[model samples]
Target chain A: MKEFETVTVFDLLIRYIKDGRIRLDRTRFEGLATYHDPCNYGRRAQKRFGHGFFEEPRWILDQCLENWVDLHPCRENQICCGGGGGALTSGYNEERIYYGRRKMEQIHASGARMMVVPCHSCHGQFNNIKAKYGLPDLSVKYLWELVADCLVWP
Target chain B: MTPENSLRISIENLERTRCAQWPHAQDNCLTCAMCSGACPVAGVDDFDPRKIVRLISMGMTDAAADSRWPWICTMCGKCEQICPMGIEIPDIIRRLRAMRARDKVPGILQDGLANALRTGNNLGLPKEDFVFILEDVAAEIAEEPGFEEFTVPIDKEGAALLTTIHNKLVNTHTDDLKHWWKIFHAAGEDWTVASDNWEGTSWGYFTGDDEAMRVMAGRIVENMRRLKIKTLLWPE
Candidate 1:
């Protein structure tokens, strides 16, 4: 609801941090992390609305994790996780996994143990990609999952 | 008439039919493979965005439309974004998808669209069932440490945030929502979920059915008006 001045969870969390309302425990997450930019929320929305949420997610990651790396060619240039445009439910399992090869390669190249994906589509896609590629070492976590895990209570 | 003459006649017919739909239809494309090169699904099922454009431009609309390539396209719009001629490849792909008969559409996508249109969610969830799931999830969350007072506000009029839920959260991955709920509780955000028409993702956008899309989107607007909520956090 940025158009109407409504804050996303990311924006609200940043506000909380700025206002000293919430402090995240950075040491809670020790594993290396990488972020995936969902196509709908990142590039397509950028082209349509003149603003993509490339930074907001990274900012959240920066606050919650001590060690994090960017997925290569990230933000607007990031490859699709191959589960968008209803492909998750479109009954094209093999093709969808095949399309995600580039993304899988990116994750493998990032060398991060965990992936931070904000979009539900991307979350599902990454989980399937991890399973399909047999990369049991890589795990996918939602942005909120990281934020909630790192939340420091007063 | 010879096969060559027949092909020319059909090409002319396709030109007359589809030219107005895309104003750039008449523009001469340089046959560059940029669009195909940028497309993620270009080589899948032997799908080539450049070839589709070429076929459509040459009045081979049937060849382009009949191929399974259009359905495989994710409609990412990267092809159009990278096109030198500014060709609307995704739009054209959407049109090809729309040309398929509703029943002939991919089963899951078609059923999801029909379910969203008929029951206000892709999973065909009833209002009571939705509320029950919300309350159930909320009660479970309440038992969590530091969230004993957590409750999912349903149909709370004038709430600052009216959020939509993806059907998968309610259907399969119910606990996935707890992450957001915990954050909302921690943030002290005033948000409510509508009991009816709470679906966020629009399968109409997926299927290219303009009417279904309009109805699905209109439900969100109608909910906002009815509840008098000014802000919406649609996370789909």
Candidate 2:
């Protein structure tokens, strides 16, 4: 803890791979994957801290998956998954799902089988959208889940 | 009295008292509707960010504040981010949320905030239950193929990482924590979670309570200080 600073799991994973702490078996994942830039870790943090973590998540995705794509209008301009701002827990399920239709459309347009989201709120929202839209082909997963799935043990 | 006439009376009252509170509420807004266009919840429950700004600018504060739309907004700051006028629309929405009486707040948000302030976590989870759940998950993981020695270290001082957890992960989806713990095990990273104030998401940020937010955040800081850990990997 002497020299370590607070960092996101994405940042830590990048460092771990670069510094040879861990090896990722990218060959394990062969599907087309798209990344969702979570508002808290991306745009809002950038606005507040003068730096947004746009690249760290993508870097994680690129390392773990052979085929990775971006959601249209991604990074700083990416749309909210509509479950943020406490809307998921706000007890407005109908309105929350209705609001997430735009995000659902984005996912549909991306044509990727897997959607990689870093935030729990986005995870919940996308899972609901997938259920509501009946898209069993599309799956929502956390960045850590992918990394753990692809870890190359010694 | 017709509906329009009654609305006029409320607008007059708003003009007399609340219009001056937000100095930039008027004149700065160009009524471009960019905020509305960019908002994810713009049309839900007839809530439009542009209309909220316009109504307030035109001394229709009561009409804007009285609606349930303000609570419906996720306050993602996308509208403010996209606003060419730099109107800070989300701030106005937050203020509107604060204006509502505590008991009048929608859903369980108010209760969550109260629980967070009282018990260090939004679900009011006791320290033992939180530890028990983590240990339970760890035991399950220990039986897995690769993780024969897995243990969720609580209060492990000087660990390289100290993490805060989302309440949903602990309360409902306890198995989700196994994903990160698996990663930690695979990477051989040093991380420990505090037995107290392990909540990561700030419900106070949602409920528009500054004091509640400070207390919730302060618990994390207090944990870090108590544990003497420097690096935090809070993902929420």
TM-score of each: 0.92, 0.92
Chain A TM-score per model, please list them.
0.91, 0.93
On the 0 to 100 scale, the lDDT of residue B38 in model 1 is 85
Relative to the real complex, the DockQ score for model 2 comes to 0.68
TM-score of 1: 0.92
Q: Interface RMSD of every candidate?
A: 2.2, 1.8
Ten-residue segment with the worst summed lDDT in candidate 2 chain B?
B10-19
How many Å off is the CA of B12 in candidate 1? 5.7
Best by lDDT: 2
For model 2, residues B1-236, the per-residue Cα lDDT tens digits are 34585456543344535545674544478888888888888877788998888776766665666678887888788898988877777778887777778888888999988888788888999998899889999999999887998899899998878999989989989988988888788778888999888889887777778888888777787888888887888645
Count: clashes, candidate 2: 0
- The residue pairs that clash in candidate 2, if any, are none
Which candidate number would show the highest DockQ if scored against the true structure?
2
For candidate 1, lDDT tens digit of each residue in A5-44? 4455566667766776567888997878899888878888
